[model samples]
Target: MKKYALLILFVFPISRTAWAQSPEVLAIRKYGTQNADKMMREFAAFLAIPNIARDTVNIKKNAAFIMSMMTERGIKNVQLLAPSTAGAPPAVYGEVKVPGATQTLIFYAHYDGQPVNPAQWAPGLEPFKPQLYTGTIDKSGKNIPFPTDGQYNPDWRIYARSASDDKAGVFTILSAYEALTKNGLVPTSNLKFFFEGEEEAGSPHLNQILEKHSALLQSDLWIICDGPVHQTGRKQIVFGVRGDAHMDLTVYGPKRPLHSGHYGNWAPNPALLLAKLLASMKDDEGRVTIKGFYDDVTPLTASEKKAMQEVPSVEAQMKRELGLSTVETTGAVLNEAISVPSLNINGMQSGNVGKMASNQIPTFATAVLDLRLVLGNDWQRQQQKVVDHIKAQGYHVIDHEPTDDERAQYGKLIKVIPGEDGYNAQRTPMDLPIAQRVIKAVQTTTTDPLVLQPTSGGSLPLYLFKKYLNANTMTVPIANHDNNQHAENENIRLGNLFDGLETMTAVMRMK
Candidate 1:
């Protein structure tokens, strides 16, 4: 019996060695490294196109570019779902079906990005010109831009629009697929790719598209290639993503701008009114004051608590990177802070926001509020609560959609235009057999301890695939945590990008 046990232990690593010794996998790792420059150049071309949301013209061009790449790579059945008023920029869809495969995997990613304020870009760094950069800029302190000419440095990375948030992720996924199929490393499961064009704009028509193409979108599992890896550079296999929602509210007073000196004491100040109204939503301690806001927040289960405890101390890391003295909320760290719901004022505008300060009271003030919802919270209902709360505060609410007569008379009245619809949070069970296979495969690829985040602070439309298709969805982000996803100076580390390709290759080949 002792000899039997010894033999079993000896065979374990030998068995793994047999599987890991594939020439295809080794060539993929080698090619990913060797072709790093070529890959960056291709990415630079993709980044050169201004693929911001709402720009249907450029959106289609970008989609066409993706389709063209897939076709050039010999991918079969590539097609573009043309844009319409219902949805902007057609979604890029394609598939590779391997005969005798028992399972199918659907890969999801976004091809669109947030609008960039060109003036915010650094000198010699236009949003369309993808140059490499390093060093950090403190927006509050100083906006200094460091330059790097596409070389790997411990402190520097490639800087460009969509470099990290998602474009890098898409590149990684495609490269992995290319490396596999190119070298005859066929995936064990049938693979399908779905690249959407409206994720940055809240995925308003995604549900409709999903419903329309239920047969084509069906899969055993859906893998979202978005977001960023752990700050420590550990490979992560996330089980879920937190849901999100945004609401724009405004306070109006006199029909037009008023002279501050003339009505200093008597006239109502919309700006001041907006500030006071915003202050009412959250307390001094950062707790939200909305009625029943916390009542429906799903409680963290024992498993989720275990996962949270396993997450590295994000507080110290955040403070060190963000140059913050301390974190907010009751917890001492940022990850803990994310365990609850949050209300943030994303943007506010009323009067002049330029160098010249006009001494006139603005007639209207608008505030864009974003609410990050946790599990067990419904997005639509929660959005309604925000509207109710504003009304409860005794101010007349002006939603974006006005009555026809009101639109004709007011001729562009001060109103709220809902920026983006909210996404519902979702979490998948970690104990599932397929999930276990993925976790084990990731462990085989890297020595870093796997960080299993129960849910991320960022938003993704995971609920749709989970609820509509009954598919198990997971996120595998390739970008570094400090990639500055939505802000200026966005970038992705070449090392991280390479590692992502290796990990993705391993995931695809996992049986």
Candidate 2:
């Protein structure tokens, strides 16, 4: 585990009121402003801890820290729910039960973040050492020294691993509880906190945890605090998330590297074969060419289609910001495209490039593929579709590497290795009574209407909650659109963090 610097102290006076704030919003605002310095210091301290799921030792430290945070805030029954497997990161669970409350809502977020490469970060920036910046890195934002006073610029951002992808979620949820209690306000619904420890690793063991503790995890609905807000800067409430799976496909050439000059024309280059195989998966129009790829996709409901039309269009601005003049014609716009499944090549490796270029042919080439599944599509069946397509290409597919006699017998040999077992897609009806209450609660804090998405392009293990607890789950994300989640330089805008506290407070007081 890596060591981090001690928390910094800021000195600033608290303001009593904010402009155009309602009475309910004012209570949260006053509490947030008065404790801005304390909250940020604690947040930075949490961010400083290393939280890679595979690092069992450091992961436990994160879980322990969260337990302490909950216990000190007067939350009851705070405990860690571990899986049957030893050394697995446990999910931190705690609840605030209101007297005579009929409805229960479980608030969810993940503590684990994607692994990072320190070299990829900008100068003077470290993944675990949280730092404040005047703005986003893409805008050439400069680093700002931690203020000695509590005063912070709302435009400033806190950069760290999991800053936006999720630690922000954990901080906002717990802090909202603290603010409401200290301000003499009580929640109308029984609230439960479920912080996952291994979401970035694809949540392979989540089902184990859920099955082992289904009785304690029951709730009317789960309000997820993850992902990002809409591109237009309005809050977003996503009803579903895409299911995910990964595949590693390798095609063989000669057993050993050979001289390009001698075997150039005589030998079939594995790199070229792999390239052709990948190209065959997609067409010039960017639509998948795999047979039955779209057969299992569920169509959108009438209300879902209406919501899609109501979403503000940001494709023109997005294309310009992404520096792309053309996009795949699979869907008319970005939202429409995510409604269907997708096949993407995450990465490919064959031989050396740049200064490492060689005049020899590599032994083999490999490509890692990602498949995104929508409702009605099964993960196993989706993977088999790709495998069946490979078989149709006249290649012998095997799970393991081929032996001498087997290699000699088969002219074209390839290997397909599937990742951990994946789950299928899940969606809750957008018009449920609980869903309406969530939308109404969040609307009280924002002037513009919220963007309700049928499914976000990202994937989560939300289906497990539905399977084990039989509860509906909805995502109310608060990170800025360009927070750079799952990448280096990830951050959360200070304004979003403040607004998120208010948003959660509103949800807690919902009728």
Candidate 3:
């Protein structure tokens, strides 16, 4: 017999709280324990399909796979929404309305992932090949394993491509439901599902989709099932997420690459020009030098600051893991680090020389920059500061596809294109009744005290659900702290996945 069956025979018979769980919840927990490996296999299969950004064909198959599974599970009201624009792929929308439920909760996640380049992945661990391994990366960057004889935990599941960035959330939610229904637990509220396909591409058309289906997307609250758990391994409930935007700026010079020896002292190097321009945007203290950049940012409330002060800090552990002696922007703790806006150079490139380097002054240089916005900051205005600063530094502002004359005059022109549609940070009032309910529900499922965060440094389109649908949003993330989300060698812990499923089950069964 299965563990759940043993649980029923041995534990449920004498338990007073056994009555607290719905039959479905009880059944699901049992089913999850008995068939955890099978569930992990299904998750691995989903991860195996390469559903990177703009690769909508496989994404469609993956979406269809979700709908098919929902259908086989007897879930109703499943539909595929066509892309709002021509040439865009569709989004799979589904819902299962519970009768007599007054409150509706919209669950959001993306089925898309960032594009992967095979060369960046480790040997024997290609982007599409899912592998299971167990090792804890300690403070010193050393991976300490329980047993180092090539024996991996059979319970742990690791996969490439959005496994934690969101496919894990999808599997956990779906499997939680399956576990519930198979065991006899029923959801307490009317549920809406919004699985987006273009989020990895900054969700360019999400606004149109939301506007088009205003009725279908209606909800009192939204629960984003993205991101990962806090660094302290405590279960977290995030009220908001920071907004993110990307920009690329370039400095232009001569028509062609100049020989360094010939014009070493004469020709102006765009690379050097760009480096100087970027350096001017940030001071030695790491404060952004863009004029009026923080003018509109909302200050943290006393309550928010108090909440942040209570979060655990493993600074030494972090320094060890990163192999760093110290952290930048010191004095304020770890939580304070993510609470503020930040500017980062994602990548930079200009001229390249093979082997024994070329002594050539590059004609042009460009940097891909990402600017994370805090609440109340204007996306367009903040982006403008970077461009305005560049122009203020005597460089041409390439605001759009330049005219022929401008391109010719600027020596091939500087360009600035927005990468991801920026999101404004969100913060739900902890005083909200639903927030309290969720806090209690998560607590009942976890052994430790829950972490209540005002905002996360990561980016999520929670703003859309709140701004467009007038809904309060929250996040219950289950991925481990070191899940390597958005980085190479991404994997999810078996224990975390199980805990998340159990938590979700508890939430669904909450009164």
Q: Which candidate do you rate higher for lDDT, 2 or 3?
A: 2
What lDDT does each candidate get?
0.74, 0.88, 0.73
Give one digit per residue, the lDDT tens place, for model 3 in 224-317: 7888777767788888778888897866767688889999888778788788888999888778888887788888887777777777777987
Comparing 1 and 2 by lDDT, which wins? 2
Give the Å shift of residue 385 in candidate 3: 1.5
Off by over 4 Å in 3: 1-29, 136-157, 353-356, 399-414, 418-420
- Top-lDDT candidate index: 2
Weakest lDDT window of 10 consecutive positions for candidate 2: 1-10
**Clashing pairs in model 3, backbone N/Cα/C closer than 3 A:** 23-184, 23-185, 24-184, 24-185, 25-185, 27-183, 28-179, 139-320, 139-321
TM-score of each: 0.87, 0.95, 0.89
Over 1-511, each residue of candidate 2 has an lDDT whose tens digit, in order, gives 0101111111111111223257987778777767887899999999999999999999999999999999999999999999988888899999989999999999999999999999999888899999999888779888988776666766788999999989999999999999899999999999999999999998878888999999999889999999998888788899999998889999999989999999998888889999999999999988899999999999999999999899889989899889988898645788988888999999999989999999988889999999999999989899999999999988899999889887898888899998775777778899998899999998887766789999998999889888888889999998888888998999998878887898899999997
Q: Please list all clashing residue pairs in model 2, or write none if there are none.
A: 10-148, 11-148, 11-149, 11-150, 12-150
Error of 1 at 421 (Å): 2.6
Quick one: best TM-score, which candidate?
2
Candidate 1, residues 364-441, lDDT tens digits: the string is: 788888988888888877787777776677665576544556644642244555545778889888777888888876
